[model samples]
Target chain A: MKLREQLTALLTSLAGVWIMSYAWIVLKLGSIHVPDAGFLPFLCGAALAVLGVAWLLALHWTKRKEAPAEKRLWHRPLSSLLLMIAYGWAMETLGYISSTLVFVIAWQQIVEKEKWAKTLSIAVLSTLAMYALFVHLLKVPIPSEFFLR
Target chain B: MDIFSGLLDGFAIALTATNLLFCLLGAIIGTAIGVLPGLGPAATIALLLPITYVIGTPVTAIIMMAGIFYGAMYGGSTTSILLNLPGEAASVVTCIDGYQMAKKGRAGAALGIAAIGSFVAGTLAVVGLTMFAPPLAEFALDFGPPEYFALTTLGLLLAVTLSGGSIIKGLIILLFGLILAMVGLDPISGKIRFTFGSIGLQGGFDFVTLAMGVFGLGEILYNLESTMKTEIVTTKLGKVFPTLGDWADSRWAICRGSVIGFFVGIIPGGGAVISSLASYAIEKKYSQHPEEFGQGAIQGVAGPESANNAASSSSFIPLLTLGIPGNAAIAMIFAALMIQGITPGPFLVAEHPDVFWGVIASMYVGNVMLLVLNLPLVGLWVQMLRVPYGILAPVIVLFTTIGVYSTQNQVFDIYAMLFFAAVGYLMRKLDFDPAPLPLAFVLGPLVERSLRQSLLLSGGDPAIFVSRPISGILMVIFVLLIVGQTIFFLRRKWKRRCCVPVPPETEKSL
Candidate 1:
């Protein structure tokens, strides 16, 4: 099986166990009112368990007949992933304006590799538009400290 | 005279310079986004929602957003007709005939046919909506959990049929999506089921980020690899305007698509996507030369493109009349409406005539605005495809991430989007349709909520669900569908297995 197929199987089994565990958790909480707080969760758990079981069985049946060719399905876009992580970390710390500008520029240059003129223009303009939108227009509470500093 | 009298009041509101401006702007922006790949109605609306929150009146805010959806439907065809690439998922079928006609140096004819077909379909669907909406809403007013569950079941079954592939795999994907939906906090109890302890896991996946990332970013990746290997298109650009004959030939196809689409749009879930696909299938089945369907037939583009617009327009029927969203975009509109303290259900017509009628009137105005804005703008959209894929690729991905994160300013939503993007990409690679998965995910909670509520309302008895005539009828349909499909599946498989004869022996005997 391919890595994704294996991962899917693993996830399916774990989901089954997780659901059964929830059922146990809800079942332990004894019923109080006519319709208990735990009732819905219990019902959901049952449904989830059923779904997980079916998923597992379905994957098994499909995969058994023909194992997926052992190959990487997609190229991991690492640059993009790390960029998003940096963007998140920088968002509040860098504040909306500085962070958004930095994030947009970094992606444009590193990932997109656009001409400097185009990248810089998009960075400046989009940041300004977003800034105007969130702060000046909507009156959304955005910290301007990163830019001012 | 009955509704027309009230409609005059609507025209009075919709015709206001500001409302007209908003309608035109909405359609223009919507069409622009639709023509440019990596953007869809849902994503555009979701990303732009923050702007609407700043605007006045929920109705006008919604009318503007709704305008964009239909406008995009019109503009999406520009690329599908000009280049083979579809501007949106729903317009994929259009590429077959639309680009084929374009390749044959009839680009003008193809574009003209698409535009006229969409206009006709949209108008007919609106008329259908005018006649049918209020009555349908009134009927929906009586719905409870049981009825909703039945509707959801019907939607699931139809989705499987509509999505071409192995039926079993489609069902499995849908079920998987539903289970994924269950991962977040349980609505009734507020207990987290599938949250693996991190704070990010609580809210569940946002559909927009998943859609844009997979469809947009993944598409870019695929294109980059493919473009590197293949010979690029070097055909000299030809006459851009379509001929009158193109428009006339597609009128019947457009009308048929529109009528089919409007009815399909009335359903509770994933109506627009379903409508476009169904219309294409029906059109192809009815076509004289079905062989030309996937090979660039103008009718292929005209019918499906028109159906998409018609469906997008008619989707308003469910949202306006029944207080139900047929898809996520409408769901956001429902959110905005509730924020404005305007209830959207049966009494909305009587209680909020200005909001209701004004929005309805704006749609009529918006349709005209969209066509005018889109037809001339086709040239601009086709040029977008000429931009180098490598450069445009990352920018699309970044924007999608930001858009999703902006929704709640939550990192969790970003992760949820990422996870689901992977799921979406996998589904795409495997030829499993992502359409049904989202529909299944959204409908899962509804099914659970209604079933529980029904059982509780019945004092712990399941019979209450079966007791209501409407509920019982719907349940029978659901049961019959499952039973029917199972039989059909077995028969098909059996026939395929048994129909074989040795080729060599048969040839020799002959």
Candidate 2:
């Protein structure tokens, strides 16, 4: 029977294997007196590999499989992941207020889709608070252009 | 007279206008983040670690940040009780009975009991912190690297107790976290660990990044996967106060929890979860109606809430005394202390009395601030529950990235955050936990430094670890912890195979 685990599970398993492989390569760098750095990562990688094996084994033992895979894409929380990446990319260029304003607006209306006035009110106030807290008060520099930046 | 004089000195520092205002701000910010779903106390402290650098006076910064810590403890139950989302580790127990209470339309009473219990616990905890802290520091002063390594091993072993559904899975995640902790440059040799030849890895994974990914972003991913499990849809119905008997019934539970939690929190590896679970079990074990535990007993909420708050406060004793943080938030506090060129240890009390007692005094003020912050703002926080994951999720990521970037002015942190986000998402998929990662990242350098120092001190003798009395005791505890958890793991696997419910692992994963 086909397994129902999501893209996340597949990625996790792949990562486990890859990290373990990297650990092996690092471990092989020397014979005796391998640095503590090498020792830790090798251990970490082995842990990952063990995890991968255990996860697969548990799935096999459980008898019941995960939910169907076809439905995974439809439920990927795509809006969230994409919007987040965009926010990160845009923040430095736009500054804190501008990017935050745009992100908040897109998030509220597009993702949350609340009424216009409420969305606008929350978006403006939150960005302003973040600005005052980080940039003005704490003196942490934030990108300041995009919104009504 | 001595106690009163000391408290008076503490109040003199805490009562200053500057400290008071900072304390209020810290409580407000801490409570805000704690109430926000997915941003646990560890991540919040980790995120704020960079900012604490900007504030003048290590004493003032520590005082204020300490406010944020227990403020979050006070804030956590609001969400768990109202939303059925265990917003913080300690609040997991709250969700069991507190959420059920909310579902049954007793959220007001549950919240009321939580606040009152937390306040009682906080007040009592300050007494414990004051009494035990100095003496503890005196004892810890004699300790050395061997003791430290043993303590770290014991701590890592206890991670098994924090396991949910699978002990092996918990240890696996912890090991991964330990390995990730190795990424930065080697402390002893100055050689890079797991940088994979990248500059980013040279510095190693910051607690902020690991915490941001594993606890904060990872939580967002988990919520996305199982939004259906949350009880927010049941009804946002709630009032703002508790009945008289509700308070009466919980008063004893709160007192018991405060005492238990204070003692437990003082122990190096024991923390809020232990207190919470222990308090809940005690309440269940001795209650007139033990059967009502999973069905939203008010005592469950009161005892656990008190225990969590007390634990959060008393943990400072260890961090300030032994230079060992009992939890991740304290670890960040340690980093903040280091940034100020201050190392917390036995002499810290005598040398940096202001930072020491200032933080101790601030807890009293912070607890009061938390109570004030929690009450009238209860409505606001519950409103936060309705903010919907879709809107809040992106903001969490955005704040995380910007926060990380703004610290170093390094654009690479954004990528690191993303990589961890992906790794975090995957860990959840494979049923791996992230709780141990921050602990590992925080303790990694300390362990690395200690191991090398021990080896150097003993002319490369590994036996040095077992040579000390303190170290030997820690080793024994470590062994017992591993053995106990192995049995637990086997029992759990047997249960899973048998299709028995495991109480949803609420309190320990607490």
Candidate 3:
């Protein structure tokens, strides 16, 4: 855990350096007397780098305390995030109803492990309900190219 | 108008048909959200932000959001008492004794006291808001750019210190938020800094997209990691009304909680979590039988429940009066106000009296609605616990997706939401609190604007921040806080270095 945290701090510090260069070189961090667009961004980047480095140093100086390891479930969240990404992609191509219906069915099965009957009924019902709420009531201009017009 | 007339005018607006309906809707959704763990009031408000566009009237939209904010406090204890699960962060303390009471077959009594205590404290806090907000706003009218800059800086610093993580990590996130806020066209120069030429990036990140992604979708994805098995209390609810003895045991506790919560909530970094924790500590200390606490003491439920509700109510003061959002939920409301073309600040009360008073008055009405919903209809809320997460999770995702998309009718926003969702998940896993990020995002523009304006006013001397009396004091405090935290961290590190056993080989090398 300590090593992971230290790595995160290191990455944050590197990101700060990148942002700083982008601001100072690209955005042109003008003189403080006549501040420009990149002035605040430059300060923010500097602060971030300083803080990130400080955190890394603090963690380095401190002794690591080993924690009792427990089995952590990551597959559900990982798969769910992937499904959401796919749903976003499919929403544009497959349209709201078709994409949402497929996504819901997949999520209920893959993440939830529900029975086919329950999953199918829930997926269809939820997709329809969401369609009604967004497209019908609120008149959100969600893509409807494929179906559920 | 004075407080009396202002309140009366507010009541007039709140009683209108549309506002009443939205208020009730907010209360219902808030209760449902509170009864369900994982989805907090902040995420719920973020999820529903786009729908406010349909509502049209900012006052009515705000009434609903405010209803959700306080109503969640009222409904949060139900799950705590019945299932030993906190419905929200504020109700975590309630689980310590509330579930014990349920085990003792006093679930009904616990639920009853929580409702009544929430009602009493929420109302009292609203009264405090009514009395305090106007004067605060009036005082804030005297502030200039330097003072505003100092105030925002203090708020960000306070959020970092109180956010319960490594101060350096919180500060890094805070700076990152500030950087994100600078991604679009420069307000002064009109020169884009970091859009990378994407048209969607031109407008920068929408507050709703970032909020929904970070809080709404992020929370859902994180919760998917572990499935909670709820062992709900099955004891038959006797009467939903508490006995007279319950009131006697908790009357002083309720009063203390109300006062504590109100004052704490007014601070920039204070909110329901700290208020409830403080109330619990105080109740345990002052109780005649401190051992009774965590062993089915009625005061345990009443005090913290009251404090969290009161804190929710009072947390609005800074937002409504000074345009500073104290927490993530209030920041969402602030975003709602901005979306509706209303800039919250000292001018809000004078310019949009209906929104100012209507929202406050509606809190009183919402509290009553929550009490009615929580006490008599608690069984209905408890049933919500049984709803399968499988259904709830997908539905939440859909709503968040459509909600983000509807804001600008853009697919880019949905993608942005997904990106932030991933970031939020990683941040949580790394033990970095994401709460301060949104708060910083919301305040970034204000801070930058105030800073630039103050520099211009002082010819870029940089002493302008510390030259003014108010801003000077605030800057002093900010420096002190930073120094204090550094000292604390170094001392701890030193202690750890000396105490830990060193290996013989390593010691010889040292």
The total of clashing pairs for model 1 equals 6
Residue-level lDDT for B248 in candidate 2: 85
What's candidate 3's DockQ score?
0.53
Q: Specify the highest-TM-score model's number.
A: 3
Write down the lDDT that model 1 would get. 0.66
lDDT of each: 0.66, 0.73, 0.88
What's the CA error at residue B102 for candidate 2, in Å? Answer: 5.1
**Candidate 1: tens digits of C-alpha lDDT, residues A1-149:** 33464465456456655655665574333342234334544544455456445545545433233433334323335566567667766766777678778877887787666788988988887778766756676666554457577
Evaluated on chain B only, what is the TM-score of candidate 3?
Answer: 0.96
Better of 1 and 2 by DockQ: 2
- Candidate ranking under DockQ, highest first, comes to 3, 2, 1
Worst 10 contiguous positions by lDDT, candidate 1 chain A: A61-70
Candidate 1 Cα misplacement greater than 4 A, ranges: A1-3, A27-76, A115-121, A147-149, B165-244, B268-297, B328-344, B387-432, B436-446, B500-510
lDDT value, residue B29 of candidate 1: 76
Q: Give lDDT tens digits, candidate 3, residues B380-447.
A: 99888999887898999999998888888778998999999998888888877787888999999999
Residue B501, candidate 3: alpha-carbon lDDT:
64
Clashing pairs in 1: B96-B296, B97-B296, B97-B297, B108-B241, B108-B242, B109-B242
TM-score of chain A of each: 0.71, 0.68, 0.91
Docking class of 1: incorrect
CA lDDT of B86 in candidate 2? Answer: 72
Off by over 4 Å in 2: A1-79, A91-129, A143-149, B1-7, B96-107, B163-165, B224-244, B267-269, B291-296, B375-377, B386-391, B487-510
